[model samples]
Target: MAVNYPNGKKFLAESHMPKTTKKKDLIYSNRGMTLEEEINSSNEHYLSSGRAVIHKKPTPIQVVKVDYPKRSAAVIREAYYRQSSTTDYNGVYKGHYLDFEAKETKNKTSIPLSNFHEHQILHMKRCILQHGITFVLIRFSFFNRVFLLNSSYLIDFWEDTMNNGRKSIPLAFIEEKGIDVAYGFNPRLDYLDAVDKLLEHTNK
Candidate 1:
C-alpha cells in the first residue's frame, strides 16, 4: 500500500544512500556490506537457524519503459516507486510480529530525524499499537556504533520535533535509551539480542 506524509509527500521505497564506500580508510568500515546488506545477511542467518523469519520488504516499482533487444533479454529503461513503503523490514519472531527500519548516519554526535519520514513513523506507531515489536536499527558508521532504539522513544522525539523541539536526537540520548548491538561474524549485525531485551522489558 502507498503511504504518504501529512503534506502529501509519497514515500519512496527505493531511496537510500550508503554512508561510506571505502573500507580501508575508515576505522569503522562496514567491510563492503552496507547497513541494509548486513541486515539482510543477518536475517538470512536467523532464517536458516530457525531463529526468526524477518525479511526486507521489496520496494515496489512502477516500470515506465522497457526495451527488448532479444526475445530472451529485456531491459528496464525507466521506473519509479509505485508506493510508499511502510518500513524497511518486518516479519514474525518467536510468534511475535517484528517490524523495523534500518538507518545509517555519518554524523557522530547526533542522528537527524529527517532520516525518518512521517508515514514511516506513523506506521511504526500503528504497529506498536497493534502489539507488534517495532524499533529502528541505526548505525553510526563513523564511530562504529550500532544501536537498536525502540519505536516509543523514536515517536517521542518525532512528536517533540513537531512541537518545535530539536530536529535530531543526540548520541548521548540514544546511548542511554537504546541498546548497543555488537557486530558479529555469522549474523553480521546481532540486533536480535537487543530485541530480546526489548521483549524482556515489554513482558515486565
Candidate 2:
C-alpha cells in the first residue's frame, strides 16, 4: 500500500521526508536580532528610562498611487524617495542636540566614501559648527564592529575625496580617531559612551 500525505501527495516507502523543526530550535532560531532591530529596541529603552530622547527619522516618500481596499484602510501602491536625508536620527540627549547617520559596511579594510552622501556630509558639518552633537555610527557588519566616527574626521575625509585622493576611509584611520562603540544588551550601539568621550575632549 502507498502512503498518502495529508496534502493529497502520495509518497513512496523509500521517499525522503521533509525535515521538521523542533520547538527548541524554533525558539533559538528566532532569537537573533538585526542591527536595526537592536538599535530601535535600545532607543525605546532609553526613552522609557528617561535617559535620552532619540528617534529614527521617518523617510519621506512621494506616494503616487494608493489602493483603497477597505473604507478604513489604504495601501500605498507606488512611491518614490522624496529627497536625500541628512541624518538617520536626531534628538535631545542631556539637553544637547544630537544628530547622526547610521550606516553599515561590509568592507574589511576601508569604508567606501560612497557609503555616505554629499548632503549628509554637509549637514553634519553645519550641525557641528552650530554646537550640535554630530557624528556617524558606522557598523562594519563583516567584522561585527561599530564605531562612532566624529564629524570632524569625516569632514576631513570628505574634503580629501573632493580633491585628488583616496575615496575611502581606512579602518586603521577610523580606529585612530574614532571611538569604538561597545555593544550591550541595552542601548545596543551604546554610542553615548563615545559621545561622553567626545564631550570630554571638547571641554578639555
Candidate 3:
C-alpha cells in the first residue's frame, strides 16, 4: 500500500522503523504490543473507569485506489493524508484539557528530538498557553521503560536543538526530570498516576 503525506512525501509509519534489539527480556515488557497500542489500551481503561476520556488523533486520508476481492472485503492500495496532525492524543481529564504525544525508541540511552516535528511542538506550545495539560509519553523500548515528561521540558530541549544543541534527550535527564509511569496489567501504562504526581508537585 502506498501512503503519502499531504505534501507528497511518503508516509513512513513508526512501526516500520528498524528494530535493533529483542524486547522480550527487557523490563516492563511490552508483551509484543507497540507503544501506540499500549497507550490505546490504557486510554480505553481510563475511559471505561470514568477517569479520563482521551483518544488517539486520527489522520484524515483520501483513498485513491482500492481493490475489492469480495463484496465485503476491500483493500486500500493507495491513500493520501488530508493534513498534518498536531498531537497523538487529546481529550479531557478531571475537567483539565489533555494533549500529548507518545514516542518510542529502541535507543536505550536517548530518544531523538527528531521524533517531534516543529509544527507539533508549536501546537503543543499553544495548548500550554491555553492552560492545557500537555506532555509526552516516551518509551525506551530497549529497556522497556516509560516516562511522562512535561511538554515544557520537551519544548526547552526542542528550542535548543535549533542552536546546535544535543539532538536527543538523555536518559539521565529524563530520569531526573520526568515521572516514571509503571506498566500494569489492567491499564497497561499507568500514566495518569504519574500525571497526578506531577500535578501535586506543581501545586506544592
Best by TM-score: 1
For residues 1-204, write the lDDT of model 3, one tens digit per residue: 564323322444556543322243244356678888788878888998999999998887899998655333355799998866589799998888989999999998899998999988999999989999999999999888999999999999999999999999999999999999998987888999999988888779
Cα lDDT over the full model 3: 0.85
Expressed as tens digits, the lDDT of each residue in 41-127 for candidate 1 is: 788889999999999998989999986654333557899987565998999988999999999999989999999999999899899
TM-score preference between candidates 2 and 3, better one = 2
Model 3, residue pairs in steric clash: none
Candidate 2 CA-lDDT value: 0.78
Per-residue lDDT for 36 in model 2? 59
Task: Point out the higher-scoring one by TM-score: 1 or 2.
Answer: 1
For model 2, how does the per-residue alpha-carbon lDDT over 11-47 read when each residue is reduced to its tens digit? 3232344323223224554245555555666687789
The pairs that clash in candidate 1 are none
In candidate 3 the C-alpha lDDT for residue 146 amounts to 95
Kindly indicate the candidate among 1 and 2 with the higher lDDT: 1
Model 1: lDDT equals: 0.85
List the candidate 2 regions with Cα displacement exceeding 4 Å. Answer: 1-32, 67-70
